[model samples]
Target: MSTAQALSPSSRAESLKKLEETELDVLVIGGGVVGAGSALDAATRGLKVGLVEARDFASGTSSRSSKLFHGGLRYLEQFNFALVFEALRERSLVLNSLCPHLAKPVPFIYPLEKLIDRPYVGLGIGVYDVMGAGRGVPSHHKHVGKKKTLESFPSGKRSAIRGSVKFYEGQVDDARHTMMLARTAAEYGALCVNSTRVIGFLREEGRVVGVKAVDLETGRAFEIRARQVINAAGVWTDEIQEMVGGRGQFQVRASKGVHLVVPRNRINSSTGIITRTEKSLLFVIPWGSHWIIGTTDTDWNLDLAHPAA
Candidate 1:
Protein backbone atom coordinates (compact mmCIF):
# COMPACT_ATOMS: atom_id res chain seq x y z
CA MET A 1 0.00 0.00 0.00
CA SER A 2 1.15 3.54 -0.71
CA THR A 3 1.52 6.09 2.05
CA ALA A 4 -0.78 9.10 2.16
CA GLN A 5 0.51 12.19 0.38
CA ALA A 6 -1.02 15.58 1.02
CA LEU A 7 -1.61 17.67 -2.07
CA SER A 8 0.02 20.73 -0.60
CA PRO A 9 2.09 23.42 -2.31
CA SER A 10 5.35 21.73 -1.39
CA SER A 11 4.04 18.37 -2.61
CA ARG A 12 2.85 19.95 -5.84
CA ALA A 13 6.27 21.45 -6.42
CA GLU A 14 7.86 18.10 -5.76
CA SER A 15 5.38 16.41 -8.06
CA LEU A 16 6.09 18.94 -10.79
CA LYS A 17 9.80 18.25 -10.48
CA LYS A 18 9.21 14.52 -10.55
CA LEU A 19 6.92 14.81 -13.52
CA GLU A 20 9.60 16.65 -15.44
CA GLU A 21 12.51 14.39 -14.46
CA THR A 22 11.03 10.92 -14.30
CA GLU A 23 9.58 8.72 -17.00
CA LEU A 24 6.12 7.51 -16.12
CA ASP A 25 4.42 4.22 -16.79
CA VAL A 26 1.07 5.88 -17.28
CA LEU A 27 0.07 9.50 -17.83
CA VAL A 28 -3.49 10.66 -17.56
CA ILE A 29 -4.97 13.76 -19.17
CA GLY A 30 -7.87 15.65 -17.57
CA GLY A 31 -8.64 16.23 -13.90
CA GLY A 32 -12.27 15.23 -13.96
CA VAL A 33 -13.68 12.20 -12.18
CA VAL A 34 -12.68 9.64 -14.79
CA GLY A 35 -9.15 10.96 -15.14
CA ALA A 36 -8.59 11.16 -11.40
CA GLY A 37 -10.05 7.70 -10.91
CA SER A 38 -7.83 6.37 -13.66
CA ALA A 39 -4.76 7.81 -11.98
CA LEU A 40 -5.82 6.31 -8.67
CA ASP A 41 -6.37 2.93 -10.25
CA ALA A 42 -3.01 2.98 -11.96
CA ALA A 43 -1.06 4.19 -8.94
CA THR A 44 -2.69 1.62 -6.64
CA ARG A 45 -1.36 -1.05 -8.99
CA GLY A 46 2.21 0.27 -8.43
CA LEU A 47 2.54 2.10 -11.71
CA LYS A 48 4.44 5.38 -11.97
CA VAL A 49 1.45 7.50 -12.89
CA GLY A 50 1.08 11.21 -13.63
CA LEU A 51 -2.21 13.11 -14.04
CA VAL A 52 -2.37 16.58 -15.56
CA GLU A 53 -5.31 18.92 -15.68
CA ALA A 54 -5.72 22.20 -17.52
CA ARG A 55 -7.83 23.74 -14.76
CA ASP A 56 -8.86 23.14 -11.20
CA PHE A 57 -10.01 19.61 -10.48
CA ALA A 58 -13.67 18.90 -11.19
CA SER A 59 -14.15 22.32 -12.82
CA GLY A 60 -15.79 20.76 -15.84
CA THR A 61 -18.81 18.53 -16.36
CA SER A 62 -17.75 16.45 -13.40
CA SER A 63 -18.67 19.36 -11.17
CA ARG A 64 -21.66 20.47 -13.21
CA SER A 65 -23.77 17.36 -12.77
CA SER A 66 -27.07 16.51 -11.11
CA LYS A 67 -25.06 15.20 -8.12
CA LEU A 68 -27.22 12.09 -7.86
CA PHE A 69 -26.13 8.50 -8.02
CA HIS A 70 -29.31 7.25 -9.56
CA GLY A 71 -30.41 4.20 -11.44
CA GLY A 72 -32.02 5.96 -14.40
CA LEU A 73 -35.69 5.37 -13.83
CA ARG A 74 -36.37 7.05 -17.16
CA TYR A 75 -34.31 4.36 -18.83
CA LEU A 76 -36.76 1.85 -17.38
CA GLU A 77 -39.38 3.33 -19.67
CA GLN A 78 -37.04 2.45 -22.51
CA PHE A 79 -36.63 -1.13 -21.16
CA ASN A 80 -32.91 -0.68 -20.41
CA PHE A 81 -32.79 -3.14 -17.51
CA ALA A 82 -29.11 -3.97 -17.80
CA LEU A 83 -27.99 -0.34 -17.62
CA VAL A 84 -30.18 0.41 -14.60
CA PHE A 85 -29.05 -2.71 -12.79
CA GLU A 86 -25.41 -1.84 -13.35
CA ALA A 87 -25.94 1.75 -12.23
CA LEU A 88 -27.75 0.70 -9.03
CA ARG A 89 -25.03 -1.81 -8.24
CA GLU A 90 -22.38 0.89 -8.64
CA ARG A 91 -24.46 3.28 -6.55
CA SER A 92 -24.58 0.70 -3.78
CA LEU A 93 -20.84 0.23 -3.91
CA VAL A 94 -20.23 3.98 -3.69
CA LEU A 95 -22.61 4.50 -0.79
CA ASN A 96 -21.81 1.29 1.11
CA SER A 97 -18.05 0.97 0.70
CA LEU A 98 -16.42 3.54 -1.58
CA CYS A 99 -17.15 6.90 0.06
CA PRO A 100 -19.97 6.54 2.54
CA HIS A 101 -18.97 9.82 4.13
CA LEU A 102 -19.40 11.64 0.84
CA ALA A 103 -22.51 9.76 -0.21
CA LYS A 104 -25.82 8.66 1.30
CA PRO A 105 -29.28 7.39 0.53
CA VAL A 106 -31.74 10.18 -0.29
CA PRO A 107 -35.36 9.41 -0.75
CA PHE A 108 -37.17 10.77 -3.81
CA ILE A 109 -40.88 10.95 -4.41
CA TYR A 110 -42.08 10.26 -7.95
CA PRO A 111 -45.42 12.03 -7.92
CA LEU A 112 -48.24 10.57 -9.91
CA GLU A 113 -50.61 12.93 -11.66
CA LYS A 114 -53.25 10.41 -12.69
CA LEU A 115 -54.77 7.29 -11.13
CA ILE A 116 -53.48 5.08 -13.94
CA ASP A 117 -49.95 6.39 -13.34
CA ARG A 118 -49.78 4.60 -9.96
CA PRO A 119 -49.73 1.02 -11.19
CA TYR A 120 -47.32 1.72 -14.01
CA VAL A 121 -44.92 3.84 -11.98
CA GLY A 122 -45.15 1.53 -8.99
CA LEU A 123 -44.42 -1.52 -11.14
CA GLY A 124 -41.33 0.16 -12.56
CA ILE A 125 -40.15 1.23 -9.12
CA GLY A 126 -40.84 -2.26 -7.76
CA VAL A 127 -38.65 -3.76 -10.44
CA TYR A 128 -36.03 -1.10 -9.70
CA ASP A 129 -36.02 -1.94 -5.98
CA VAL A 130 -35.78 -5.64 -6.72
CA MET A 131 -32.94 -5.17 -9.17
CA GLY A 132 -31.12 -3.09 -6.56
CA ALA A 133 -31.64 -5.69 -3.80
CA GLY A 134 -28.79 -6.25 -1.32
CA ARG A 135 -26.92 -3.42 -2.99
CA GLY A 136 -26.46 -1.42 0.27
CA VAL A 137 -29.50 0.86 0.17
CA PRO A 138 -33.04 0.22 1.33
CA SER A 139 -34.32 -2.10 -1.37
CA HIS A 140 -38.04 -1.44 -0.98
CA HIS A 141 -40.18 1.43 -2.23
CA LYS A 142 -43.31 2.82 -0.55
CA HIS A 143 -46.45 4.09 -2.23
CA VAL A 144 -47.84 7.18 -0.50
CA GLY A 145 -51.49 8.17 -0.72
CA LYS A 146 -52.57 11.66 -1.69
CA LYS A 147 -52.94 12.80 1.93
CA LYS A 148 -49.48 11.54 2.86
CA THR A 149 -48.01 13.04 -0.27
CA LEU A 150 -49.54 16.39 0.62
CA GLU A 151 -48.27 16.04 4.14
CA SER A 152 -44.75 15.34 2.89
CA PHE A 153 -44.86 17.97 0.16
CA PRO A 154 -47.22 20.71 1.18
CA SER A 155 -46.17 22.87 -1.74
CA GLY A 156 -47.24 20.19 -4.16
CA LYS A 157 -50.41 21.02 -6.05
CA ARG A 158 -53.24 19.10 -4.40
CA SER A 159 -55.30 18.99 -7.57
CA ALA A 160 -52.47 17.89 -9.86
CA ILE A 161 -50.70 15.26 -7.74
CA ARG A 162 -52.74 12.07 -7.16
CA GLY A 163 -50.14 10.07 -5.13
CA SER A 164 -46.45 9.22 -5.18
CA VAL A 165 -43.91 6.43 -4.92
CA LYS A 166 -40.93 6.94 -2.65
CA PHE A 167 -37.59 5.37 -3.48
CA TYR A 168 -33.97 5.81 -2.43
CA GLU A 169 -31.12 7.12 -4.55
CA GLY A 170 -27.59 8.16 -3.69
CA GLN A 171 -26.60 11.82 -3.25
CA VAL A 172 -23.14 13.36 -3.26
CA ASP A 173 -21.32 16.62 -3.64
CA ASP A 174 -19.91 15.94 -7.08
CA ALA A 175 -17.13 18.51 -6.84
CA ARG A 176 -15.90 17.29 -3.46
CA HIS A 177 -16.21 13.69 -4.51
CA THR A 178 -14.06 14.37 -7.57
CA MET A 179 -11.48 16.40 -5.65
CA MET A 180 -11.14 13.59 -3.13
CA LEU A 181 -10.62 11.12 -5.94
CA ALA A 182 -7.66 13.20 -7.09
CA ARG A 183 -6.32 13.53 -3.55
CA THR A 184 -6.63 9.80 -2.96
CA ALA A 185 -4.86 9.16 -6.23
CA ALA A 186 -2.06 11.44 -5.05
CA GLU A 187 -1.93 9.52 -1.79
CA TYR A 188 -1.50 6.34 -3.79
CA GLY A 189 1.60 7.79 -5.51
CA ALA A 190 0.01 9.43 -8.52
CA LEU A 191 1.72 12.64 -9.50
CA CYS A 192 -1.35 14.85 -10.01
CA VAL A 193 -0.96 18.46 -11.15
CA ASN A 194 -3.64 20.92 -12.17
CA SER A 195 -3.31 24.15 -14.16
CA THR A 196 -1.09 22.28 -16.59
CA ARG A 197 -2.39 22.14 -20.16
CA VAL A 198 -1.31 19.68 -22.79
CA ILE A 199 -0.67 21.59 -25.99
CA GLY A 200 0.64 18.88 -28.27
CA PHE A 201 1.44 15.21 -28.52
CA LEU A 202 4.98 13.84 -28.75
CA ARG A 203 4.96 11.11 -31.33
CA GLU A 204 7.64 8.94 -32.97
CA GLU A 205 7.13 6.43 -35.76
CA GLY A 206 3.43 7.27 -35.81
CA ARG A 207 3.02 6.24 -32.15
CA VAL A 208 2.34 8.55 -29.22
CA VAL A 209 5.12 8.60 -26.60
CA GLY A 210 4.39 11.62 -24.44
CA VAL A 211 2.91 15.14 -24.39
CA LYS A 212 4.08 18.72 -24.74
CA ALA A 213 2.52 20.76 -21.98
CA VAL A 214 2.61 24.26 -20.50
CA ASP A 215 2.08 25.19 -16.89
CA LEU A 216 -0.62 27.82 -16.97
CA GLU A 217 0.46 29.13 -13.58
CA THR A 218 4.11 29.85 -14.54
CA GLY A 219 3.89 29.91 -18.34
CA ARG A 220 6.63 27.26 -18.51
CA ALA A 221 6.54 24.66 -21.26
CA PHE A 222 7.81 21.10 -20.76
CA GLU A 223 7.49 17.56 -22.02
CA ILE A 224 6.29 14.57 -20.02
CA ARG A 225 7.33 11.15 -21.28
CA ALA A 226 5.16 8.13 -20.59
CA ARG A 227 5.04 4.59 -21.84
CA GLN A 228 1.26 4.91 -22.11
CA VAL A 229 -1.07 7.92 -22.13
CA ILE A 230 -4.78 7.85 -21.45
CA ASN A 231 -7.10 10.65 -22.46
CA ALA A 232 -10.01 11.09 -20.07
CA ALA A 233 -10.77 14.68 -21.02
CA GLY A 234 -14.55 14.06 -21.37
CA VAL A 235 -15.95 16.64 -23.83
CA TRP A 236 -12.49 17.88 -24.68
CA THR A 237 -11.50 14.49 -26.03
CA ASP A 238 -11.73 15.65 -29.62
CA GLU A 239 -9.42 18.58 -29.02
CA ILE A 240 -6.79 16.33 -27.44
CA GLN A 241 -7.09 14.03 -30.41
CA GLU A 242 -6.51 16.97 -32.73
CA MET A 243 -3.09 17.62 -31.17
CA VAL A 244 -1.98 14.31 -32.66
CA GLY A 245 -3.00 15.42 -36.20
CA GLY A 246 -5.99 13.12 -36.71
CA ARG A 247 -9.52 12.48 -35.67
CA GLY A 248 -9.77 9.76 -33.07
CA GLN A 249 -11.72 6.59 -33.70
CA PHE A 250 -14.71 8.21 -32.04
CA GLN A 251 -15.89 11.79 -31.60
CA VAL A 252 -17.21 13.45 -28.49
CA ARG A 253 -20.24 15.75 -28.54
CA ALA A 254 -21.03 18.10 -25.72
CA SER A 255 -24.50 18.21 -24.21
CA LYS A 256 -25.38 21.27 -22.19
CA GLY A 257 -27.22 20.54 -18.94
CA VAL A 258 -28.65 23.46 -17.02
CA HIS A 259 -29.63 23.27 -13.32
CA LEU A 260 -31.13 25.86 -11.00
CA VAL A 261 -30.64 26.30 -7.28
CA VAL A 262 -33.36 27.88 -5.19
CA PRO A 263 -33.88 28.27 -1.47
CA ARG A 264 -34.98 25.02 0.20
CA ASN A 265 -38.23 26.67 1.32
CA ARG A 266 -39.11 27.27 -2.30
CA ILE A 267 -40.16 23.64 -2.51
CA ASN A 268 -41.84 22.46 0.65
CA SER A 269 -40.95 18.81 0.30
CA SER A 270 -39.43 16.53 2.90
CA THR A 271 -37.84 14.45 0.20
CA GLY A 272 -36.80 15.04 -3.37
CA ILE A 273 -39.34 15.00 -6.19
CA ILE A 274 -38.86 13.47 -9.65
CA THR A 275 -41.39 14.14 -12.35
CA ARG A 276 -41.69 13.77 -16.09
CA THR A 277 -41.22 16.78 -18.34
CA GLU A 278 -42.10 17.05 -21.97
CA LYS A 279 -38.51 16.69 -23.17
CA SER A 280 -37.01 14.90 -20.18
CA LEU A 281 -37.31 14.16 -16.47
CA LEU A 282 -37.14 16.90 -13.85
CA PHE A 283 -35.55 16.65 -10.42
CA VAL A 284 -36.14 18.84 -7.40
CA ILE A 285 -33.39 17.67 -5.07
CA PRO A 286 -32.84 18.83 -1.53
CA TRP A 287 -29.49 20.47 -0.93
CA GLY A 288 -28.19 21.69 2.41
CA SER A 289 -30.03 25.01 2.53
CA HIS A 290 -31.44 24.97 -0.98
CA TRP A 291 -33.19 22.86 -3.57
CA ILE A 292 -31.51 22.03 -6.90
CA ILE A 293 -33.91 21.83 -9.82
CA GLY A 294 -32.90 21.21 -13.38
CA THR A 295 -31.83 20.30 -16.07
CA THR A 296 -32.41 21.19 -19.69
CA ASP A 297 -30.49 18.97 -22.11
CA THR A 298 -29.54 20.34 -25.49
CA ASP A 299 -26.73 19.94 -27.97
CA TRP A 300 -24.00 22.50 -27.48
CA ASN A 301 -21.48 23.62 -30.11
CA LEU A 302 -20.17 26.78 -28.55
CA ASP A 303 -17.20 27.46 -26.31
CA LEU A 304 -16.33 24.28 -24.39
CA ALA A 305 -14.58 26.03 -21.52
CA HIS A 306 -17.30 28.52 -20.67
CA PRO A 307 -20.89 27.80 -21.59
CA ALA A 308 -23.48 30.51 -21.02
CA ALA A 309 -26.76 29.43 -19.43
Candidate 2:
Protein backbone atom coordinates (compact mmCIF):
# COMPACT_ATOMS: atom_id res chain seq x y z
CA MET A 1 0.00 0.00 0.00
CA SER A 2 1.00 3.56 -0.69
CA THR A 3 1.79 5.62 2.39
CA ALA A 4 0.51 8.74 0.71
CA GLN A 5 3.83 10.56 0.92
CA ALA A 6 4.59 9.79 4.57
CA LEU A 7 8.10 10.64 5.74
CA SER A 8 10.90 8.29 6.79
CA PRO A 9 11.43 7.58 10.52
CA SER A 10 14.09 10.19 11.04
CA SER A 11 12.11 12.66 8.97
CA ARG A 12 9.02 12.01 11.05
CA ALA A 13 11.01 12.56 14.20
CA GLU A 14 12.33 15.80 12.79
CA SER A 15 8.77 16.84 11.88
CA LEU A 16 7.58 16.08 15.42
CA LYS A 17 10.41 18.16 16.80
CA LYS A 18 9.52 21.04 14.50
CA LEU A 19 5.84 20.85 15.49
CA GLU A 20 6.88 21.36 19.11
CA GLU A 21 9.47 23.96 18.29
CA THR A 22 7.30 26.21 16.13
CA GLU A 23 3.74 27.54 16.29
CA LEU A 24 2.08 26.93 12.92
CA ASP A 25 -0.64 28.93 11.21
CA VAL A 26 -2.80 25.89 10.60
CA LEU A 27 -3.06 22.38 11.99
CA VAL A 28 -5.39 20.16 9.96
CA ILE A 29 -6.80 16.88 11.24
CA GLY A 30 -7.81 14.02 8.90
CA GLY A 31 -6.10 12.95 5.67
CA GLY A 32 -9.16 12.90 3.41
CA VAL A 33 -9.69 15.21 0.45
CA VAL A 34 -11.04 18.16 2.41
CA GLY A 35 -8.18 18.00 4.91
CA ALA A 36 -5.63 17.70 2.10
CA GLY A 37 -7.20 20.59 0.24
CA SER A 38 -7.21 22.77 3.35
CA ALA A 39 -3.53 22.05 3.96
CA LEU A 40 -2.72 22.87 0.36
CA ASP A 41 -4.64 26.14 0.50
CA ALA A 42 -2.96 27.20 3.75
CA ALA A 43 0.52 26.29 2.56
CA THR A 44 0.00 28.01 -0.77
CA ARG A 45 -0.75 31.23 1.11
CA GLY A 46 2.71 30.81 2.74
CA LEU A 47 1.33 29.65 6.08
CA LYS A 48 3.16 27.13 8.25
CA VAL A 49 0.95 24.03 8.28
CA GLY A 50 0.75 20.55 9.77
CA LEU A 51 -1.76 17.80 8.86
CA VAL A 52 -2.32 14.67 10.90
CA GLU A 53 -4.32 11.60 9.86
CA ALA A 54 -5.53 8.73 11.98
CA ARG A 55 -4.85 6.19 9.25
CA ASP A 56 -3.65 5.88 5.67
CA PHE A 57 -4.62 8.66 3.29
CA ALA A 58 -8.04 8.15 1.65
CA SER A 59 -8.58 5.16 3.92
CA GLY A 60 -11.91 6.61 4.99
CA THR A 61 -14.94 7.76 2.94
CA SER A 62 -12.83 9.83 0.57
CA SER A 63 -11.72 6.71 -1.29
CA ARG A 64 -15.28 5.44 -1.59
CA SER A 65 -16.87 8.29 -3.55
CA SER A 66 -18.92 7.40 -6.63
CA LYS A 67 -15.80 8.42 -8.64
CA LEU A 68 -17.93 10.89 -10.63
CA PHE A 69 -17.84 14.63 -10.32
CA HIS A 70 -21.26 15.53 -11.68
CA GLY A 71 -24.03 18.08 -11.55
CA GLY A 72 -27.18 16.42 -10.32
CA LEU A 73 -29.67 16.83 -13.15
CA ARG A 74 -32.23 14.96 -11.06
CA TYR A 75 -32.09 17.84 -8.63
CA LEU A 76 -34.01 19.87 -11.21
CA GLU A 77 -37.25 18.63 -9.64
CA GLN A 78 -36.24 20.51 -6.50
CA PHE A 79 -35.14 23.49 -8.65
CA ASN A 80 -31.54 23.17 -7.48
CA PHE A 81 -30.03 24.75 -10.58
CA ALA A 82 -27.40 26.71 -8.69
CA LEU A 83 -25.99 23.55 -7.12
CA VAL A 84 -25.96 21.77 -10.46
CA PHE A 85 -24.16 24.63 -12.16
CA GLU A 86 -21.59 24.92 -9.40
CA ALA A 87 -20.91 21.19 -9.53
CA LEU A 88 -20.47 21.31 -13.31
CA ARG A 89 -17.99 24.14 -12.96
CA GLU A 90 -15.90 22.20 -10.46
CA ARG A 91 -16.12 19.08 -12.65
CA SER A 92 -14.80 21.02 -15.63
CA LEU A 93 -11.89 22.38 -13.60
CA VAL A 94 -10.93 18.94 -12.37
CA LEU A 95 -11.06 17.42 -15.85
CA ASN A 96 -9.35 20.35 -17.56
CA SER A 97 -6.85 21.64 -15.01
CA LEU A 98 -6.61 20.08 -11.57
CA CYS A 99 -6.16 16.37 -12.43
CA PRO A 100 -6.87 15.66 -16.08
CA HIS A 101 -5.09 12.34 -16.12
CA LEU A 102 -7.16 11.02 -13.22
CA ALA A 103 -10.57 12.38 -14.31
CA LYS A 104 -12.14 11.64 -17.67
CA PRO A 105 -15.47 11.48 -19.53
CA VAL A 106 -17.94 8.65 -19.09
CA PRO A 107 -21.07 8.51 -21.25
CA PHE A 108 -24.42 7.91 -19.52
CA ILE A 109 -27.72 6.69 -20.96
CA TYR A 110 -30.94 7.99 -19.45
CA PRO A 111 -33.57 5.64 -20.85
CA LEU A 112 -36.97 7.04 -21.77
CA GLU A 113 -39.88 4.64 -21.35
CA LYS A 114 -42.53 6.49 -23.36
CA LEU A 115 -42.72 8.42 -26.60
CA ILE A 116 -44.67 11.19 -24.89
CA ASP A 117 -41.85 11.54 -22.38
CA ARG A 118 -39.32 12.38 -25.12
CA PRO A 119 -39.86 16.13 -25.50
CA TYR A 120 -40.14 16.82 -21.76
CA VAL A 121 -37.14 14.71 -20.81
CA GLY A 122 -35.10 16.14 -23.68
CA LEU A 123 -35.91 19.69 -22.61
CA GLY A 124 -34.88 18.99 -19.03
CA ILE A 125 -31.64 17.39 -20.16
CA GLY A 126 -31.07 20.37 -22.43
CA VAL A 127 -31.44 22.66 -19.46
CA TYR A 128 -29.03 20.46 -17.55
CA ASP A 129 -26.53 20.77 -20.42
CA VAL A 130 -26.93 24.54 -20.51
CA MET A 131 -26.27 24.80 -16.79
CA GLY A 132 -22.88 23.21 -17.43
CA ALA A 133 -22.13 25.90 -19.98
CA GLY A 134 -18.49 26.83 -20.79
CA ARG A 135 -17.15 23.59 -19.39
CA GLY A 136 -14.51 22.01 -21.67
CA VAL A 137 -16.10 18.67 -20.93
CA PRO A 138 -18.82 17.66 -23.40
CA SER A 139 -22.10 19.24 -22.30
CA HIS A 140 -24.32 18.00 -25.12
CA HIS A 141 -26.84 15.21 -24.69
CA LYS A 142 -27.48 12.90 -27.64
CA HIS A 143 -30.86 11.39 -28.54
CA VAL A 144 -30.49 7.67 -29.28
CA GLY A 145 -33.21 5.48 -30.73
CA LYS A 146 -34.17 2.26 -29.01
CA LYS A 147 -32.10 0.10 -31.37
CA LYS A 148 -29.06 2.31 -30.99
CA THR A 149 -29.45 2.29 -27.22
CA LEU A 150 -29.47 -1.49 -27.21
CA GLU A 151 -26.45 -1.56 -29.49
CA SER A 152 -24.62 0.54 -26.94
CA PHE A 153 -25.84 -1.34 -23.88
CA PRO A 154 -26.98 -4.83 -24.83
CA SER A 155 -27.59 -5.80 -21.25
CA GLY A 156 -30.51 -3.42 -20.73
CA LYS A 157 -34.05 -4.74 -21.10
CA ARG A 158 -35.65 -3.37 -24.27
CA SER A 159 -39.10 -3.07 -22.67
CA ALA A 160 -37.80 -0.63 -20.08
CA ILE A 161 -36.15 1.70 -22.57
CA ARG A 162 -38.25 3.14 -25.39
CA GLY A 163 -35.27 5.38 -26.24
CA SER A 164 -32.21 6.78 -24.51
CA VAL A 165 -30.35 10.04 -24.03
CA LYS A 166 -26.58 9.87 -23.88
CA PHE A 167 -24.50 12.49 -22.13
CA TYR A 168 -20.97 12.94 -20.83
CA GLU A 169 -20.03 13.31 -17.17
CA GLY A 170 -16.77 13.23 -15.19
CA GLN A 171 -15.27 10.10 -13.65
CA VAL A 172 -12.15 9.69 -11.52
CA ASP A 173 -10.05 7.35 -9.44
CA ASP A 174 -11.23 8.56 -6.03
CA ALA A 175 -8.42 7.08 -3.97
CA ARG A 176 -5.70 8.25 -6.33
CA HIS A 177 -7.24 11.69 -6.73
CA THR A 178 -7.45 12.14 -2.96
CA MET A 179 -3.88 10.85 -2.54
CA MET A 180 -2.67 13.31 -5.17
CA LEU A 181 -4.23 16.15 -3.20
CA ALA A 182 -2.19 15.17 -0.12
CA ARG A 183 0.93 14.76 -2.22
CA THR A 184 0.42 18.18 -3.76
CA ALA A 185 -0.17 19.70 -0.31
CA ALA A 186 3.10 18.21 0.88
CA GLU A 187 4.85 19.52 -2.21
CA TYR A 188 3.57 22.96 -1.23
CA GLY A 189 5.20 22.54 2.24
CA ALA A 190 2.41 21.03 4.40
CA LEU A 191 3.66 18.46 6.88
CA CYS A 192 1.50 15.44 5.94
CA VAL A 193 1.58 12.72 8.57
CA ASN A 194 -0.64 9.60 8.48
CA SER A 195 -1.25 6.91 11.11
CA THR A 196 -1.26 9.61 13.79
CA ARG A 197 -4.45 9.70 15.88
CA VAL A 198 -5.64 12.80 17.66
CA ILE A 199 -6.18 11.74 21.23
CA GLY A 200 -7.48 15.10 22.41
CA PHE A 201 -7.47 18.78 21.78
CA LEU A 202 -5.17 21.38 23.34
CA ARG A 203 -7.57 24.01 24.60
CA GLU A 204 -6.52 27.25 26.29
CA GLU A 205 -9.37 29.08 28.06
CA GLY A 206 -12.50 28.98 25.88
CA ARG A 207 -10.75 28.71 22.51
CA VAL A 208 -8.99 25.83 20.74
CA VAL A 209 -5.26 25.98 20.05
CA GLY A 210 -4.00 22.61 18.86
CA VAL A 211 -4.09 18.84 19.38
CA LYS A 212 -2.48 16.05 21.38
CA ALA A 213 -1.84 13.12 19.05
CA VAL A 214 -0.27 9.67 19.18
CA ASP A 215 1.98 8.30 16.48
CA LEU A 216 0.40 4.88 15.81
CA GLU A 217 3.58 3.32 14.47
CA THR A 218 5.94 4.22 17.29
CA GLY A 219 3.32 4.59 20.03
CA ARG A 220 4.79 8.00 20.83
CA ALA A 221 2.77 10.98 22.00
CA PHE A 222 3.27 14.52 20.68
CA GLU A 223 1.54 17.89 20.73
CA ILE A 224 0.93 20.22 17.79
CA ARG A 225 0.31 23.89 18.49
CA ALA A 226 -1.32 26.13 15.92
CA ARG A 227 -3.14 29.42 15.55
CA GLN A 228 -6.06 27.59 13.86
CA VAL A 229 -7.09 23.95 14.04
CA ILE A 230 -9.44 22.40 11.48
CA ASN A 231 -11.41 19.21 11.87
CA ALA A 232 -11.95 17.64 8.49
CA ALA A 233 -12.69 14.34 10.13
CA GLY A 234 -15.74 13.50 7.95
CA VAL A 235 -18.10 11.25 9.95
CA TRP A 236 -15.88 11.54 12.99
CA THR A 237 -16.37 15.28 13.11
CA ASP A 238 -19.05 15.00 15.80
CA GLU A 239 -16.73 12.99 17.98
CA ILE A 240 -13.93 15.52 17.61
CA GLN A 241 -16.33 18.35 18.33
CA GLU A 242 -17.58 16.65 21.49
CA MET A 243 -13.98 16.15 22.62
CA VAL A 244 -13.57 19.94 22.60
CA GLY A 245 -16.54 20.22 25.02
CA GLY A 246 -19.05 21.58 22.51
CA ARG A 247 -21.57 19.99 20.24
CA GLY A 248 -21.19 21.33 16.74
CA GLN A 249 -24.04 23.17 15.04
CA PHE A 250 -24.81 20.04 13.06
CA GLN A 251 -24.61 16.30 13.59
CA VAL A 252 -22.95 13.91 11.18
CA ARG A 253 -24.76 10.66 10.43
CA ALA A 254 -22.64 7.90 8.93
CA SER A 255 -23.86 6.18 5.76
CA LYS A 256 -22.37 2.97 4.48
CA GLY A 257 -21.93 2.70 0.71
CA VAL A 258 -21.22 -0.58 -1.07
CA HIS A 259 -19.61 -1.05 -4.50
CA LEU A 260 -18.88 -4.16 -6.54
CA VAL A 261 -15.97 -4.52 -8.95
CA VAL A 262 -16.17 -6.86 -11.90
CA PRO A 263 -14.02 -7.58 -14.95
CA ARG A 264 -14.72 -5.46 -18.05
CA ASN A 265 -15.57 -8.52 -20.13
CA ARG A 266 -18.50 -9.33 -17.88
CA ILE A 267 -20.30 -6.06 -18.63
CA ASN A 268 -21.00 -5.44 -22.31
CA SER A 269 -21.06 -1.70 -22.74
CA SER A 270 -19.54 0.87 -25.08
CA THR A 271 -19.61 3.45 -22.28
CA GLY A 272 -20.45 3.77 -18.61
CA ILE A 273 -24.13 3.57 -17.60
CA ILE A 274 -26.42 5.03 -14.94
CA THR A 275 -29.97 3.77 -14.44
CA ARG A 276 -32.74 4.78 -12.09
CA THR A 277 -33.88 2.65 -9.18
CA GLU A 278 -36.74 2.87 -6.78
CA LYS A 279 -34.63 4.23 -3.95
CA SER A 280 -31.55 5.59 -5.75
CA LEU A 281 -29.45 5.67 -8.90
CA LEU A 282 -27.24 2.72 -9.93
CA PHE A 283 -24.08 3.52 -11.83
CA VAL A 284 -21.81 1.09 -13.65
CA ILE A 285 -18.55 2.97 -14.01
CA PRO A 286 -15.69 1.86 -16.21
CA TRP A 287 -12.49 1.43 -14.26
CA GLY A 288 -9.23 0.45 -15.90
CA SER A 289 -9.94 -3.18 -16.91
CA HIS A 290 -13.01 -3.51 -14.77
CA TRP A 291 -16.46 -2.10 -14.00
CA ILE A 292 -17.50 -0.74 -10.61
CA ILE A 293 -21.19 -1.47 -10.18
CA GLY A 294 -23.08 -0.43 -7.11
CA THR A 295 -23.52 2.14 -4.40
CA THR A 296 -26.05 0.94 -1.91
CA ASP A 297 -26.54 3.74 0.62
CA THR A 298 -28.03 3.10 4.06
CA ASP A 299 -27.54 4.17 7.65
CA TRP A 300 -24.51 2.76 9.40
CA ASN A 301 -24.39 2.18 13.16
CA LEU A 302 -21.50 -0.22 13.43
CA ASP A 303 -17.81 0.38 14.02
CA LEU A 304 -16.80 3.76 12.65
CA ALA A 305 -13.25 2.63 11.93
CA HIS A 306 -14.19 -0.50 9.96
CA PRO A 307 -17.72 -0.73 8.55
CA ALA A 308 -18.65 -4.23 7.43
CA ALA A 309 -20.51 -4.82 4.16
- Per-candidate TM vs. native? 0.97, 0.93
lDDT of 1 by residue, 1-309 (tens): 643456787887888899999999999999999999899999989999999999988999999889999888888878999999999999999999999989989989999999899999899899999988847676579999999999999999999989999989999999999899999999988999999999998888888989999989899999999999999999999999888887988899888888899999787899999998988789999989999999898889999988778
Give candidate 1 regions above 4 Å deviation.
1-4
C-alpha root-mean-square deviation, each candidate: 1.4, 2.8
Q: lDDT of each prediction vs. the true structure?
A: 0.91, 0.84
lDDT of 2 by residue, 1-309 (tens): 332454566656666677777888999999998898898889889999998899988999888778888887667656898888888899889989878888987888877788887897788778888888747576588889999999998877878878888888898888888788887777777887888999898988877888899999889898889999999999999989988888987799998888899999997888888776897777888888989888898999989988778
With a 3 Å backbone cut-off (N, CA, C), the pairs that clash in candidate 1 are: none
Task: Please give me the total number of clashing residue pairs in predicted model 1.
Answer: 0
